[model samples]
Target: MEMLRRWLAAGLWAGTLLVPVHAEEPSVEAGLRVSRIGGCHDCHTQGFAETGGQIDPSMALKGSPVGFMGPWGTTYPTNLLLTVEPMSEDAFLDFAKTLETRPPMPWFNLHYMTEFELRSLFRYIKSLGEPGEPAPEYLAPGETPKTPWIVFAPPQMPE
Candidate 1:
């Protein structure tokens, strides 16, 4: 009994010595939920809104050809996969906090998300595999876009 106890103790100690400590793996499922409810798919995924939110998982976050035009100019939904491809989790969190985009993008929302949520989101985007093609370049104010775009003029107020 004594010999067995000693052997077990040594084995446990050896196991602990070999185990590497790392941060918990970010939850991809949580990230997916965030993507859906956060309106990411509505813009970033081509045809997502038009198709009534039934986009294939394979084509998600690849960006859209459609642009949102306003007084600030025209902007396209960026390929989120490519946007974060080069960023580490920390960098992504920092970028999210400071993001400021034109017109339609809800950039302010990122600033309010917790670090865990952001990390999970980053992991989820990265897990989608290879990045998709880049979106069209930004068109300055008054410049017409070659692709289809939605105009964002203010609604006429009733006098």
Candidate 2:
């Protein structure tokens, strides 16, 4: 009877201890969920739910070769699928905290996420494992891109 009681107690203790661990570690579904909510696909891939475009699961997280031009210059989203390809998760997390990406990246949007969410995002992107060409180099104002990825039209002014 005493042996049984000890086993039960250990089981209960372990159960309680593991809850936070499981919560902190995102499952595949959870990671994917947060990625959508975080709008990661908008810039990283060609089509995403947020832009009213169809989802292309096969092309997920491959960085955009296209460029976004603005007064700040032309910027392209990094290949998030490779978030951890060059570094460990710990290192990626550190880099994320101080991420100063170019325009339209919305890195600032990520600064407030919990570590769990960030890790989940990292895990989700890592799951993709598809490497894309690095984003085109930044073009300063007045500099012309060698291969213009996108053409712009003059913004319409309200009469």
Candidate 3:
């Protein structure tokens, strides 16, 4: 019986060694990583997409002037810095979990983010300097957008 117990322990130890370990990155660093890979800069930062991501970091997350026009009307990226600037970490987490917004915002993705990831994101955005101007208001369907906008119309099927 003692010999069997020793063998089982050894097997468990060996199994652990075979498993790959991925340590969680620190909150702010993890947030920054998530932001980059999640494509937050692509729409939230002005010139970020057009410049192929060469824009200054200072300009990031301040919101873009461009609008994405679709069937739901025009939606602009919000100023992330300002959005979370006043929220407590816990409040931000709760807000993220329940966030819902217009088209192209990908607000649904926030519901899947872990608490640690959400906290990290809030910390990272807060670290960026003071907030800038807010994006233009949402335009109802058929309303003309004053700023430069991208039309997200459905593609024509090649019959």
List residue ranges in candidate 2 displaced over 4 A. 1-24, 49-53, 146-159
lDDT of 2 by residue, 1-159 (tens): 999999999999999999987666655677788778888887777666455955577668776767777777777777676556887777777887888776778888778777777777777777775665665667887777665565444588999
lDDT of 1 at 90: 95
By summed lDDT, the worst window of 10 consecutive residues in model 1 runs over: 17-26
List clashing residue pairs in candidate 1. none
Please give the RMSD to the true structure for each candidate, in Å: 7.2, 6.0, 3.7
Ranking by lDDT: 1, 3, 2
Best by lDDT: 1
Per-prediction TM-score to the true structure, in the order listed: 0.81, 0.71, 0.81
- Please write out the lDDT profile of model 1 over residues 13-41, one tens digit for every residue: 98887665344456898798788988899
Question: CA lDDT of each candidate?
Answer: 0.88, 0.74, 0.85
lDDT tens per residue, model 3, 1-159? 999999999999998886754455437777887788778888888878778776477788888878899999998999898898789989999999999998888999889988778888888898888897888888999999999999999999998
User: Which regions of candidate 3 deviate over 4 angstroms?
Assistant: 1-26
- Collision count for each candidate, in order: 0, 0, 0
Better of 2 and 3 by lDDT: 3
